[model samples]
Target: MAARALKLKPPPARLWISEWPRGAINAARLAGARRRLREVPRGDGRPVLVLPGLFNSDRSNFALRGYLNRLGYRAFPWVLGRNLGARTIGVEGERLFARIAAVAAETGAPVTLIGVSLGGIMARLAAHRRPDLVREVITVSSPFAGDPRATNVWRAFEWLTGERIDDPRVAALREEIARPLPVPATAIWSASDGLVNGRACRIGGERAIEVVSSHVGVQLNPDVLVVIAKVLNGQNADHD
Candidate 1:
């Protein structure tokens, strides 16, 4: 059978307008952290490593890491400073590989990788290159299944990474990054996302899940958090 072609259209302009309100609501999530904590299942203290999106640093995932910690998981930040795309993935992804190995060694078990947006793409790549160190992979709002230009942030990504969207190297890397992960993987996407086309985020298969959230708010969206908790606790038998 022939491979399916990717449809690459940017999301409607109106969707972008919802971002502001959604972000504001997500910011308010901190106020209910204690309450939200009771709603999700706890983990077995397995290590979880979180990666931030482009232009973001470990600080961007503070809330997420904190939440995971409260759930009895040993969550850690990437500690790689701001995400700058190709630079961090260079040397055949040695930097990321080393980090995963370190985390696995520290936990005495493979680590679960939870990435947000661009970070999700990196997580998938890490899992592909070193499945032995990865327990599972979960991506939020990552457009790994479609053309790189299928998102509103493509230009910003180019600006931050210093790589042209059409550059051969960038294209090749995207193709490699889009390959199916060797470890179990889940793609959590939001239909109301403004930065990227939601359709482009689907990984195609039983592992794809859809929620209602904004691109910037997905990290804090209550529904998204619940899903993450479920996946981490190995309670999502439907997807697995």
Candidate 2:
């Protein structure tokens, strides 16, 4: 049977310029509301590994990792440096699987993966291939369920990864990542996202959480943080 491909359009250009300002506002809100985060449920000390978005490095996720750490989870950085699509992680994401395996081995348990933007897509890929090493996956603003061209950053992705959106390998990888994960998965998306289409971020038959955040700053949004904390604390099953 032929593979299923969903073709969704990217977010509007008018929303693109609002990304930075909205992100800044969300960052400020997070800073002021740090105390409220302490009120959220604590984690069970599970290992959680975070992956950065395209053109981003561990630094981009520093705030998120710190928040998870404060909540009692052992949050670790991807440590593979900046994300440049297949160039940094490989076409089959072997490095990402190795990283997940290493964390699982060190912690003596499966690690939950939290990925932002492009990193979320990579997280899903790793979970699909190495479910034994992953406890669960949480994606923020990742467009793993539709046409790669459905993102505003597709051109940038092509330039950085040196792979065309129409490449057969890309198509195959998309199919694999979009498949139902062996382990539990959750998608945190925003219809107001300024990069990828929000519909593409959500997959069928998985828990989906909607937030009013921009694609550029969804990772740092305090609401997103709370939702993630709840999911990790096993308190977000209502969304299922």
Using TM-score as the measure, the top candidate is 2
lDDT of each: 0.82, 0.88
Clashes of 1: 0
Best by lDDT: 2
1-240: candidate 2 lDDT, tens digit per residue: 333657788889998889999989988899888787787888889999999998899999999999999889999999999999888897689888888889999999999999999999999999988888899999999998889788888999989878887888888888888888889999999889998899999877899998889887777888888889998988853332
- Predicted candidate 1 versus true structure: per-residue lDDT over 61-94, tens digit per residue: 8888888898899999988889998687564678
lDDT of 2 at 103: 90
- Each prediction's TM-score against the native? 0.92, 0.96
lDDT of 1 at 127: 86
Instruction: Give the C-alpha lDDT of model 2.
Output: 0.88
